[model samples]
Target: MSQILKLFNFIRIFWFLILPLVCFGQEKEKPRLELGGAFRVNYVYSSWKEEQKTKGGEFGYDMFRINAKASYKNIFLNAEYRLYSEAFGGGFLKQGWVGYKFNKKDELHAGLVYVPFGIKQYNSHNWFFNITYYVGLEDDHDMGLKYLHTGDKWDYAFAFLKNAEELNFGGGVENSSSRYSYDVVGRNKETNQFNGKVVRKLGQHIKHRIGFSGQYGSLYNIDTNKNGHHYALGLHYEMNWKNWNLKTEAITVSHAPENAPGESNKIIKMGAYGTPYEVASDFNMYTAAVSKKISVNWGPISQIEVYNDFGYMQKKEKEFTDSFQNVTGLLVTAGQVYTYIDYAAGYNHSWLGGNFVDDFSAGNPDAKWEARFNINIGYYF
Candidate 1:
């Protein structure tokens, strides 16, 4: 851990030292450097099963991030450093990339960046994101090289990513279950991965965007000395008009097991909660959200946004019941600050951390609802 801290400090010092030079040393023709970040705090309450209810509210600093970007002619550098309270993680580099522009509409980048999957921007209004996020398939980032192109009516991105989502250099116990971290399990010793997405817009007042994404890679099972295939396909759509926005996505992911009968379900280990658990080989998820923005000037609030989000997950095996989650929230923005208050409920099972369905189920197959209340405040600079 000390070594990791030292490395982090070095990177921090290096960036801080170079930022001033990049901002002022360039000629006037060069684009000016941009700096921004946000600080957030949250309070949470959960009332699930009798034993899992929160007696007192959980409150603390959520996260803080610093963003820096600069452009010298067509060459650009962008980076962000994130610090989270103990509950999330100590600190980490969320994004750090350097890119070169080939033209006004095309650019190439290398380093740690977001994977090209699902919705690119504003997919969910909730802080936990959608179900895809819990399944290690949504809004995820990785180390890779990427190519991006933006057009008047269309946009596309393609990337080559490392088999392992994030690099772990300290040789410590890997947090296999945490949604914030990544680990390869089962016979699938991940190799290389290819991901790409394309989006096209249609209509005018009721503008719409549709996207398709796919990923493929190889996996190995060490116990049997066998290899298999890992792949996923996703479809997403978004529509906006006046003051309302709607988004939806569906994804199918599979991990083929070596030597397993084609008609039988393959058992595989997946990351969840802070550890890994075994589940069927194939999983499918569907999510949708609708939000309405209202411009208002009441007290210190200048705008109010209300949204409802829903997600459903289906496991290949019938023994394990499916899961569903829904969230309704209101976001109020005042100047550079915003506050979000939400009520979330889940049934059968959910990936949203606080759900206590497993504890209450007690071998019962029937679904029960688990609920939580969350409030978060953030300030941007």
Candidate 2:
């Protein structure tokens, strides 16, 4: 009779689509689920007649990073994976996110995150009480959408971005057969990036933070089709005492090239072409650290650390030999934190560029004096 009326209309549309998920799982009650993870294994020996030789020194395993987080209530999830060796395998760009929580702690995030804009342990090192020469700051991470607010002492974050895809530090084999060679030097693929921040906690161990960030598009060089418009501005500060900690950060960058070309301007002009082109640059950083906590007999273990870091770069390149006006770095770290081992030693005095140090000769190689030593063993679940 019409095949039993099409099987009774497919069982009444599958019971009207599971009847509102069984009455919303019996009118839900709470306590969704939770899980967490963390792991890091490192041991490094250093060398840098100018850069690149920490693959292993008298030993190996420069670094290792892994992280995970999950929650269900107002919805949440997070990820982190990092490693500096083995040919960049787990170097998956460092983060991933999904969030929602407008109550238990105000959060509303969305994928490929972290534009929180600075000063959370120098842009965060997956937080486990980080202290590695406290390298001033500038670990800009992008690809974002965020809004986070937390309280007890006030915290805030705001973001909007997409200016990734650059990190090739030019090595010349024709700039390594150019494919944009990882393009990073105030990268801006097309405009569209934003940032915000605020943090306060004073009178209980002091804390204060401020932020503003930037990036704007237009920088085309599709084989010299030339174009312009670039920008950046930043400020940051942090302080703590009891064992002591202090920080400072500053940045100002500009590149306004539009029709730039000249031997005395016959046509193109916009900050007038200067070699590899980066008409202006400025970056400054400062750091300080002091630690104390020692109670022995193999119980409360150890905590002995010392720190220092200062990195500065100010250039106005027009190829005055690739302009590197002020480049500096001075780092010193001493560590011994134990429940089960975490030893460190660093003697880094700067002059190598960008991703800190993996050595592709980015700081353009003119300054010298390098040192690094590391050790780690971690466990927490």
Candidate 3:
């Protein structure tokens, strides 16, 4: 009698739960399609190099990219691919995700999707981005499934990422890990990661968003045949006051890798753009950016934005040197043509002039400052 009653109660509860979802899935809706892409070029002047200053810098082709989005009823898709010079990383998929909308405020996403951390879209105002970018925490993505809930004044996302996107299905390793976005690669790999983010908005005219993010993952050592761990916590803030915008965030990251004998655990290897480099295993990062839009009528140009972005990384080891980056720039919008002109400066930074792998790792305590003047122009369609 007791077993029969339990089975009857379970069936009754499932009937009510499954019937509505089955009915909603049957509703007919029109399909939608959208496709877009962009072409961009860059001119850069490296102040740290003597020849660049003497020859007036170099102008070169940057990249071309394609983006697509489609929807059929509650099911939707988004994908993007980019082609860069061979010296950069060749061709790669920036993002490709399939989603299902549970309702107006809830959705589910799967595949290579952005990790919900720090700020939503970005945490920097310049082309150089922030310090967290180099260490593989900001604007990072992975193969994962995500659940999102967006309320009027609150947004929440949770994800479980299996690993980084692999360029080939060799089931082993590739000679080149060239791809977009930083990830744990080389002798070590990332797996079984969980991420969560929550944000709440306040104020009306002077709006502010306070958010928090958390992550935990496993670091698999191919050689050691053991697993280490990594985790990060971040606090994010954003403000919008009329024409001004602000974004700021502080984060602490720790990675403990099971390295082989004679290997140092203070740093781990990360790879992207066909290159692998060492990054400090533990550090605190901070970033802040502010921008203001000015309406103007200058020929085809209608509006321009003036902004500054700053990033800093402080290694917890105390023996390791710190890194700093700052960029001030203007973005001009003229119909389909958008342009960015900026000057970026940094100390103990990789892209800015300090040694690539060493700068973000132990770093050179006596490293001098390096600067770059850059202009990027792109056409969107």
Off by over 4 Å in 2: 1-31, 37-44, 48-70, 77-112, 116-214, 217-316, 319-380
Tell me the tens digit of each residue's lDDT in model 3 across 38-141. 99999999988889999999999998887767676788878777777777776777788989999999999999999999887878777777777777777887
Please list the C-alpha lDDT of all candidates, in the order they appear.
0.71, 0.41, 0.85
Per-residue C-alpha lDDT of model 1 across residues 116-204, encoded as one tens digit per residue: 88897546887667656655676666677899999889999999976554444432333234334333543345556798899998889
Please write out the lDDT profile of model 2 over residues 227-308, one tens digit for every residue: 5555555566666667556655565555453332432211111110111122222223333333333333434433433443
Worst 10 residues of 1 by lDDT: 355-364
Clashing pairs in model 2, backbone N/Cα/C closer than 3 A: 167-182, 274-318, 329-350, 353-363
> TM-score of model 2 relative to the true fold?
0.26
The full ranking of all candidates by TM-score, starting with the best, is: 3, 1, 2
For each candidate, give its TM-score against the true structure: 0.84, 0.26, 0.91
What's the number of clashes in each of the models? Answer: 7, 4, 1
Instruction: Indicate which candidate wins on lDDT.
Output: 3
Ranking by lDDT: 3, 1, 2
RMSD for all candidates, in order, please. 4.2, 22.8, 10.7
Measured on C-alpha atoms, candidate 2 has an lDDT of 0.41
Worst 10 residues of 3 by lDDT: 2-11
